[model samples]
Target: MIVITAPTGNIGRPLLSQLLESAPAAGEELRVIVRDPARLPDTARGRVEVITGSHADAKVLDRAFEGADAVFWLVPPDASRPPHDGYSGFTRPAVQAFAAHGVGHVVGVSALGRGTPVADRAGLVTASLAMDDLIASSGVAYRALANPSFFENLLEEADSIRDKSVFTDVVDADRRAPLVAVADIAAVAAGLLLDRSWTGTDSVPVLGPQDLSPNDLARIMTEQLGRPIRYERQPLDELHTTLVGYGLDEEFVQGVVDMKRAKDQGLDAGVVRTPDTASPTTFEQWCAQILAPAVRS
Candidate 1:
């Protein structure tokens, strides 16, 4: 049996579908941990076992992990909490649950550029690496799907794009970084979960289609939507203040701002290409296929 947590989320939605499609052919069963089963799409209904639970609920996690041979683990970011403590609180319980359940394998969602000097620059990434290590030591077959930024992040600016003709980020205009589709991340995760042959603390980085600076991304969005869209680089100090005002800890906001600064300084350079591990989706393709229709309506 394969158990997937966060099965209704951006990555988990498609991932659950892929697992359902692949499970029948492989003669496997699937279980999905959802906080609310009724909120799941009709397509996902009756396709797999829906276990209601949060990652932190041990009793619920035990029930979901029961009889599960493999699991796709993901720690959703809690921006409300201190950034350094977010992943830790989420992953520790998961690790404990996995150990108790005797689950055989796990595929985890993680961030890129972990274990580098810039690792600490992104508190979230640093904490994720620690979580990966904890899972590895649990003696379970594990794959850490370290993905770069997701293009879906742009959706946060839908209203701004509609009213102001601009999208903003802390990244520099000319600093290119790999941006992946959550769908591609889901596909790679599904592939890992289905393949029992792969094992042990493997860090799989999904580079997406190619690298693009915010300026390049802005150009693509403008061309795709046939409008004049622009990139507005948010000031780090202002960004930090906004995040803090949003109820995040000051230290957490500072760490996030530091990460943005690291990106501006080209800290994500010298990436390794793993052409076969997984195929990635492009930002323009995602914009055309996913974002454009949503924005048009």
Candidate 2:
């Protein structure tokens, strides 16, 4: 049996599709913990058992994790909530349920930078790493899908990019960092969840084909869209003010700032992309296939 959390999310949605397609031959039974049953497609709701509630709730987790052999865990981000409450606090209950319910394997969505200069200071990444530690302490074989920035992030700025041919960020325009596509992350998660050969806890780095700076990304977008695209570098302080003005809590705002600082200081730049870690999708490919369509719409 397999239990997945955040089934309606970017990674979980795709992962559920892959698992459902592959489960028949393996005779695997699948289930999901989703807050809203309506958010799930009718096809998915019919195919798997749905436990409708937040996975962070003890009773919800207990009901969802029972009789499950492997689980896909993702702690959803809530900006108004405290870091501990959103990340580690939520995982604590699910971790207890994992031990109590005898779930043997866990595949979690985490970030890269476990052992780096800014790992301790990178706000969101620091909390995510702490969540990984809590899960590992539970004695279940775990794999944390440690990923860099996702190509999907561009969608958040697609409207601005479409209107002005520009995207903005606090990271250095010249800082080349690993930018992965979430589909690659989902594919990796589905593969690990389906196989039980590995033991103990480990971090799987899912970097994209190559490191690309914001300028590089701009150039690619220009070619793909047939228009000049530019990257506007917003100062960290200004960006912090902007997010705060949007009603985000101070801690959440700080984490976003800290992550940009860490990325600018080369936290993601050091990761070596190889056949194992390198995903097939590239920035150009994602622009043409994914981002461009969203912009056009």
Candidate 3:
């Protein structure tokens, strides 16, 4: 049996779809811990067992982890609390449940910069790494998928791209770093969850095919979307002020600022993309396939 948390999220949704198609062939029974079962795809109904509730809840995880051989873990973002509480605190109960239920393996979604100089101070990434350590301490064979920024993040600026022909970020226009598609992350997670021959706790970096700067993204967007799109760099202080204005927790807002600063300082530049670490799907391809449609619609 394999249990998947956050099955309706960006990464979990695709991971669940892939597992639905492949797990049955491997004689694996699937289960999902979700807050709202009604949000699941029509194809998932009557196919996998559904455990309704937050996976962060001890009772929910206790039931979900029972009889489970492997688990696909992804924590949903919670900006109402500090980074540590949002990440590690939300995962503590599940860690205890993993030990009690003896779940053999786990694959978690995490960020890049594990051993880099900036890692310890990268706020949210630091908390996420600590969460990985907590899970690994449970004696489960764990693989934390260390990833960089997502191409999908640009989806948030769809309106800006469509109306103003511009997108904004805190990163420098010329700072090149790996960026990935969430679908590719899901593909990597599906492979690890299906084949559990690997043991021990380690991180798998899902660096995309190439490194891209904000300017490179703008150039690709301009070409793929058939328009003049430009990159606008937002000041770090302005980003923090904007997030705080939206009423997010002050500490959580600070976490975002710190993460952006670390990325600017090369937090995500630690990993070298190899065939093993590099995932398919280029930024230009994602623009044509995903972003273009979103902007047009």
Candidate 4:
């Protein structure tokens, strides 16, 4: 049996879709822990067993993990709490459940910067790494998909791109770093969940095919969308103030600031992309297919 959490999220949705098509052929039964079963794809309805509720809930995890051989674990972002509570605290119950239920393999979504100099101070990434440690201690074979930023993050600026032909970020325009598509992350997760052939407890870096700077993204967006898109660098202080102004917890806001600062300091730059580490989706393809449609809409 295979279990998936947050099956309706960006990464989980695609992962679930891939598993729906492939798991049955692999003799795996599918189950999902979701807050609202209504949010799941209509096709998933008579196919996978549904455990309605938060996966962070001990009771929900108990039922979901029982008889499950593998689990695709993902913690939904919660800006209402501190970083530690949002990641490690949310995962504590599931760690116990994993040991109790004897679930063999677990795949989790996590950020880059595990062993880097900035890792200890990288706030949310630090908490996420701690969560990985908590899970690994459960004796399950765990593989944390260590990822950099996502191309999909640009969707948040779709309106700005459409209206002003601009996008903003905390990083410098010339700072090149790996960026990936969530679909690629989902694909990697699905592959690991299906073939749990090897794993003790380690991270699998899913760096995208190439490193891209904000300026490079702007140039690609301009060409792809047929508009004069430009990159604007936002001050880190301004980002922190803006997030806090939106009523996010102060500590969580700090976490966001720390993560952006660390990224700017090359925390995510430590990983060299190899054929084994690189994922297939390119930023150009994503901008044309995903961002273009969003900007047009």
Estimate, for each residue in 1-297, the C-alpha lDDT of model 4 and write its tens digit: 999999999999999999999999999999999999999999898999999999989999999999999999999999999999999999999999999999999999999998899999998999999999998999999999999999999999999999998899999899999999999999999999999897699999999999999999999998899879999999999999899999999999999999999999998998889999999988889988889988898
lDDT by residue (214-235, candidate 2, tens digit) is: 9999999999998999999999
Over the stretch 146-231, how does candidate 1's per-residue lDDT look in tens digits?
A: 87778898898888887787999988789887778898899988888888897667888887877889899889989998999999
TM-score of each predicted structure versus truth: 0.95, 0.98, 0.99, 0.99
Residue-wise C-alpha lDDT for candidate 3, range 1-297, written one tens digit per residue: 999999999999999999999999999999999999999999899999999999989999999999999999998999999999999999999999999999999999999999999999998998899999998998999999999999999999999999999999999999999999999999999999999999999999999999999999999999999889999999999999999999999999998999999999999999988999999998988988899999999
- Report the poorest 10 consecutive residues by lDDT, candidate 2: 265-274
Colliding residue pairs in candidate 2: none
Once superposed on the true structure, which residue ranges of model 4 sit more than 4 Å away at CA? none
Better of 1 and 4 by lDDT: 4
Error of 2 at 224 (Å): 0.7
Off by over 4 Å in 2: none
lDDT sort, best first: 3, 4, 2, 1
Overall lDDT per candidate, in order of appearance: 0.81, 0.90, 0.95, 0.94
What would the C-alpha RMSD of candidate 3 be, to one decimal place? 0.6
